[model samples]
Target: METITENQKVRAAKKLKKMFGHVDLRDTSLICPIRDVMAVASDKWSILIVLYLGYFPVLRFNELKKKVYGISNKVLSERLKHLEGDGYLKRTMYPEVPVRVEYKLTDFGHSYLQKLIELTEWAETHKNCVISNRTSYHGS
Candidate 1:
C-alpha cells in the first residue's frame, strides 16, 4: 500500500472540512446530503446491486436477487426502489400477459459505479490483511 504523506492527509482533511464545515448538528432541519446519499448507496446490498448492474448492464428482479445472494425479496425490492428514486437506476415495465420489468443503471449510476470500482478494488486488494488484522484484534 502507498503511504499517505502528511501533506496529503492535511489536504484530505481540508477537503472534508470544506464539504462538511457548514453542517450544524444543533439544527434538526438541516440535512446532510452526503450522509443521506451514502446511507443508501454505500450499503453492502446496494454496492453489490450496482456492481452487478455494471457488469450485466440490465437485469430483472429475480436476476438481481440471484446475483446479489442472501438478500431477501423485501429488502431487494426496497433497495431497488431506493436506488431508482436516487436516480442511480431505472425501472422499465412492459405490457404483456404478465408484466415484464427490467433494471438498468443510468448515466449517474455508471459514474457512481466508477467510484465504487475503485473502492471495490481496494477492498479486494486488502481483504486478507483486513481479515488478519481482525483475527489479531480478536485473538488479543
Candidate 2:
C-alpha cells in the first residue's frame, strides 16, 4: 500500500482547513462535527440515494434500498436518519393499517443536490484521469 507523504498530507490539511473555515487538527471534539456532517453526505450509498431521490419526489424505505444496491437495512435506516437530522431529507409516516413511510429531499437538500450535480459533472469529466492516477498509485 502507498503511504501519503508529509507534503501531500500538509497540502490536504491546508485545503480542508480553507474549505471548512476552522478545524483543529489536534482536538477530537473539534473534528467530530465536521466528520459527522461528512459521514452523513460522503458515503457512496448516500450520494446515490440523494441522486435517485432527485429524480423522484419520494421513495419508500424498501424502494430506496432496492435502488441503492449493496446497502443493508440497518445502514439504510441509519443513513436516512442522519440525512433527516442534517436537514437534507424529510421522512413522513402515514397512519393506516399497513402504515406507509416515505423519504424525500427537503428544499435545502435540493439546493445541496444542485451543488452535488455540479461536482458530479466535474468528477465525470476527470474520471478517466482519476482512475489512471489511482491505478498507477496502487501499482496495478
Candidate 3:
C-alpha cells in the first residue's frame, strides 16, 4: 500500500491551482457547502439508489434492498435518510396492518436521473471496449 504524504497533496493542489487558475482556498464558507452537497451525492448507495429509482419509481424498501445487492440494513437506512434530507428522494409511509414505506425520486432527483441515463447509454455503447481495455491492463 502506497502512503500519500502531505507534500504530495500540497504539490497536487498547487498543480491543480496552476492548471485551473483563480482558485480561492481562503473561501471556507463557499467550499463547505459544495463539499457537503458532494458528500451527499458521493455516498456509495446514493447514486445507485437514485439510478434504480430512475428506472423503477416508488419501490418498497425490501425491493430496493434486493435490487442493490450487498447493502446492509443500517447503511441502507442511513442512505435513505440522507437522500430524503437532501430532497433527492421522497419517502412515503402508508398506514396499514404493517407499515409500508416507499421511495421515489423527487423532481430534483429526476434531473440527476436524466444524466445517469445518458451515462448508462454511453456505457452500454462503449462497454465492450472498456472490458477489453481492463483485460489488457490486468493481463488476464
lDDT of candidates 1 onward, in order: 0.94, 0.89, 0.87
For residues 15-87, write the lDDT of model 2, one tens digit per residue: 9779666755676787787778887898887898899889889999999999999899999999899889889
**On residues 9-99, what C-alpha lDDT tens digit does candidate 3 reach at each position?**
9999999877546647776675687689888876768878999998898899999999999999998999999999999999999998699
Pull out the clashing pairs in model 1. none
Q: Which candidate tops TM-score? A: 1
lDDT score, candidate 1, position 19: 73
Which portions of model 2 miss their true places by more than 4 Å?
1-24, 138-140
Ranking by lDDT: 1, 2, 3
**What lDDT, from 0 to 1, does candidate 1 have?**
0.94
Q: Estimate each model's TM-score.
A: 0.91, 0.77, 0.72
Which candidate has the highest lDDT of all?
Answer: 1
Evaluate model 1: give its TM-score.
0.91
Compose the digit string of candidate 1's lDDT tens values, residues 1-140. 56879999999999988876887867645666766999999999999999999999989999999999999999999999999999999999999768989999999999999999999899998899899999999995
Query: How many pairs collide in each candidate, listed in order?
Result: 0, 0, 0
lDDT of 1 at 31: 65
